[model samples]
Target: MTRISTSIIYLILFFINVRFVKNQQTTNFSCEPRPTQADTTDKLQRLRAHLVNNNLFAYVIFSEDEHGSEYVQLYDERRAWISGFLGSAGT
Candidate 1:
């Protein structure tokens, strides 16, 4: 093959290899053990009790990402600490 054509082929192959490697570097997720329903309920109840003790009518919980981005990451889920809701925006 011509040198130019060989170089182009090598360039394409290089990019494909780089992309494959990059994809491999992405985060891997596996099924992880989670809190039971009773445990979650107890946590919420305790939070309510704390609020009542403080005479607060209501309270809000917010979670922040490691980067403090407007969008919270799954690992940084604040409300999930108690409410179990995975939404980005919630009370």
Candidate 2:
């Protein structure tokens, strides 16, 4: 009886682990389209030069304004200016 219960418990745990892993893999899948070379080539070159001049390895651009507002004005669209992605998500 003890061995039977242990085996059942192990089987339940194994299925739960498999289910969790599958759920994680599904959540990791992205449908967003990747930026092509035509979309970012020239812009990235200018950005890279600016980074090198400032001795910085990377820079993060946000779509928010001074008030933390996602709906920003044309002047505050820094991320769009660089990446040409005017989506709601910020970089």
List the pairs of residues colliding in candidate 2: none
Looking at candidate 2, what is the lDDT of residue 51? 59
lDDT digits (tens) for residues 20-60 of candidate 2: 54344223334554655225546766766675678654454
Top lDDT hit: 2
Predicted structure 2, TM vs. truth: 0.47
lDDT of 2 at 3: 42
Residue 18 accuracy (lDDT) in model 1: 51
Q: Report the C-alpha lDDT of model 1 over 1-91, residue by residue, as the tens digit.
A: 8846765665666556655543453334564447553235567667757755796544545456557587766667767878777555433
Clashing pairs in 1: none
Off by over 4 Å in 2: 1-40
